[model samples]
Target: MRAGGNIEITDLMRFGHLAAAVFAGWILIAPSIDCARRGLQRETPLSEWEHMDTFTTQQGCESYRATVIEAEKADSKNLYNARYAYSLCVRDDDPRIKGE
Candidate 1:
């Protein structure tokens, strides 16, 4: 967290592998969802997804997700074409981001 309790992008990259911290707030799961090849990735556990930075508010989480998707679009390798490969903004307590 910086001077404003805001997380830097680099921090997210550094800790991307640790998806579910289950903080007291909310979190964004920016997993690599290739439904075309994996079929919704339902067999994969949420903890395996690439976790984005945590947010205190739903609006903030969605805003960051949009920002990330926009940036990903610039990269030709992004998974925007997938049927369900978008970041999810859910409360840390959400069971979906936990053990299956």
Candidate 2:
């Protein structure tokens, strides 16, 4: 204790160390806590049935769409056909569309 019963240098140092430890613990666990909270809040997966496919050209996307259609036609009960029936191609270079 200081002459006036105030906190001494050692006490300050101890408090600083404790604060540092708490801060470090929070940093380590913050992400996990946030992820857990998000998991609880999420009722379903972000994209349960939809997926984005990137292709170098429009023809590639068309080809994939055709393939998906054929696969659907081959088996109406196929899950892929039901999920991707209205598949459309967007040009990567098109300014109106966003690219990933």
Candidate 3:
């Protein structure tokens, strides 16, 4: 069978394909735009916490401490990054730039 010329599609199939395309586009673009707007940036990988001393001993105790540390570190990094991005956005958009 030949490919890449033209394929037949029913009306329902065409609508379904269009809906899927739109849904996929929104799934891809919405989070990124929200991230840019709110500065919900990605944090550095901290999987090393799993192998740290505090976590390498007792499995349960270690897992708890590791989770706490990892969460705190992630929170810290997120706050700093978000503030930095917000400051940048604010600087660009501030009306005080006109020297009023």
**Highest-scoring model, lDDT:** 1
Q: Give the worst 10-residue stretch by lDDT in candidate 3.
A: 24-33
Against the reference, the lDDT scores of all candidates come to 0.66, 0.47, 0.34
Tell me the TM-score of each prediction against the true structure.
Answer: 0.53, 0.38, 0.19
Ranking by TM-score: 1, 2, 3
Worst window of 10 by summed lDDT in candidate 2: 25-34
Deviation of model 1 at 88, angstroms? 0.7
Off by over 4 Å in 3: 1-9, 23-100
Model 3 scores a C-alpha lDDT of 0.34
Cα lDDT of model 1 overall? 0.66
RMSD of each: 12.9, 18.5, 17.0
Give the per-residue lDDT digits (tens) of candidate 3, residues 1-100. Answer: 2356656466558988787645431000001214455643234122111121221123444355445446556566565333333221112112332233
Candidate 2, overall lDDT? 0.47
Q: Kindly list the per-residue Cα lDDT of model 1 for residues 1-100, writing each as its tens digit.
A: 5666898888887686455443357788756566577534545667766666888888998887777666666665545523224567878877777764
Q: Measured by TM-score, how close is model 1 to the native structure?
A: 0.53
